[model samples]
Target chain A: MKRFLVVGSRDLTEYVNGKYVPLVVEELRAKGHDVTLFLIENGVIAARDGSKAGKVLNGLSDKGARVYAEDVSCRARGVQTLASGISFSNLDFLADSIAEGFDNIVWY
Target chain B: MGKTEPPGSKKKKTQKVAIILSTGSYQREAPTTVLRLAEKLLERDIEVNVFAFEEAVTLTNRDQIEHNEPPSLRKVLGDRHVYVGKFVDQLLRVGLHGAKMDWVTCVLCAQERGVENHQIGGSIVGTLGDLWKFVRGADHVIAIPTYR
Candidate 1:
């Protein structure tokens, strides 16, 4: 399976074209490709417990796509608790992941 | 000052990363995010290529200066502020020693913004060809477009 890394830097409420990132992630998962959703900056808002974005991310996680919220971003925004299936990550993970190689790396 | 490999010896290929920054600084967090990622990537010994276009061409403007904040806003604005160009300059300088970083400012964009000749040292005025070249040669590519 082709590997994909999608980085989301904006909050869900700031969609310019109807939440393109989630749709792209969903499509990739539907196609059976491995996908990792990395949330950074304000994008960590999606990992907050009980938030609307968290629900959407939960759905994607149920489909086997991995989700990670940047630790620094989460702390900066005071996102103390994260929704299920979302793990705290750091830039180190991001750098290592890039070095590991991916078929596609998209930023939103 | 560099070591050369033997005529027939195989040399390890260095990893290369290309970051396309299309947004300007201060207004959004995209520029800061891209810079942080570039630094982290370089620390891993990866060669970084930054292709700046649109308003991003102003990021390396050498005219950036930190001025004293007005008295009314001193509490919030602080006495001094850090400009993004300083970080870009620092990265370029440090990259000279280890994993090299090449920062290219789009010529057309810089000209339109009147920053073509105001860019910091080592900022290359390049065309779309450089952007495509970086993308084609990179082992990984990260594109941060305008967030607005």
Candidate 2:
């Protein structure tokens, strides 16, 4: 399966553009591609437990897509707790991922 | 002894990242985020190429000044507010000692914003061709749009 690293920097509050990340992730998962959703900056808001965006992420997680929220971004926004299946990551991981090579890298 | 290849005959296979930044500073956090990411990438010795277009061209304006906060808001705003240009300059300086970084400001965009002649010392005034060159050479690409 082709590997994908999708980075989202916007939060759900910006509904118009924010929705595309989840939508695209869902489609990629449906096609059985390996996908990693990396939420950074304000995008970490989607990892907060009990939020609508969190629910969507949870659903995506259940579908087998790996979801991660940047640790610094989460702390900056005071998002201490995360939804189930979402893990905390750092820019090091991002850099390493890019170094390791991905079939596709998408940024939002 | 093995035959020596000509100097500079082969290009180094260094990992490179291209960041397309279309957003300006102060109004949003995207430029700050781009700077942070660029620093982190450089720490890993990844070459960074930043293609700044639209309002992002204003980020490299050398005329940026940090003024003291107004007396009324000084308590919360601190004595002086740091400008994004300072950070950009610092990053460029740091990159000089380690992994290289090219901060290219679109010529058309800079002219539109009247920052063509005011760009920081290290930043290059480039055409759209330079943007495509960065994209073509980079192993990874990150685009920070103007909207968000």
Candidate 3:
């Protein structure tokens, strides 16, 4: 049960529409590993309230997965705030990820 | 900073900064992280490269498959960047074609997507070795994984 970061950036539907994220996170957590998410740029956009990605993200959050975004990336892309799913983070989170020795998983 | 420097230098120090687009759907805007990071690295005169392989190669297709973000990855890769795409044509359908990755060594990904060694895109059938080299040579390898 190691900590892992599953980056969900592109396809909102898979997780948002299809519930892929909830299923995977549920299974991973069921297995006893801590799971988190870092949605950035367009990824962060998915987090917007009322967005499909947002709904999906909300579901994952309900299940105990901590979610975040790269603040710097968000700023560069003009994303002022992250939506329903999670909070925004500074690049320091990237360091936190490395410091904590979390495995990175990807979802586009 | 010979791989022993403190990690906090990320903001102050420059990095070689090469990223593997992998081209899979998982990358999304993050895949462009390669381009974003590359631009930053290039500002400091560091080198940046985009390597594509595996099902990741499927990324080049810009057809806007249902329920995706706007400005497909190909649109993002267009801004003065260098990337290698296996099944490069698949990416081209999305309007991505600058430097096809021919200079690097290619090996068969255990799953094998290309046809007779080639997939729909006339890509140089590739493998994990290609990925390993990118990881070994570059400062860091960020994978933008996609799921169907």
Candidate 1 error regions (>4 Å): A16-18, B1-14, B70-78
Can you give the TM-score per candidate against the true fold?
0.90, 0.89, 0.49
- Tens-place lDDT per residue, model 1, A13-75, is 777653778889999999999888989999999899999889889888998888889988998
In model 1, how large is the Cα lDDT of residue B45?
A: 92
**lDDT (Cα, 0-100) at A77 in candidate 1:** 98
* Complex DockQ per candidate: 0.24, 0.22, 0.10
lDDT of 2 by residue, B1-148 (tens): 1121111212333399899999886767789888888888788888999999899998999898888898999899899988898888888998768988899999999999999999999999999899999999988788876673
Which stretches in model 3 have alpha-carbon errors above 4 Å? A14-18, A72-81, B1-19, B23-31, B35-130, B133-141, B146-148
Docking quality category of candidate 1 according to DockQ thresholds: acceptable
Interface RMSD (one decimal) of model 1: 12.0
Error of 3 at B80 (Å): 11
Using TM-score as the measure, what is the rank order of every candidate, best first? 1, 2, 3
Where in model 2 is the C-alpha error above 4 Å?
Answer: B1-14, B71-77
Whole-model lDDT per candidate:
0.85, 0.84, 0.51
The top-ranked prediction according to DockQ is 1
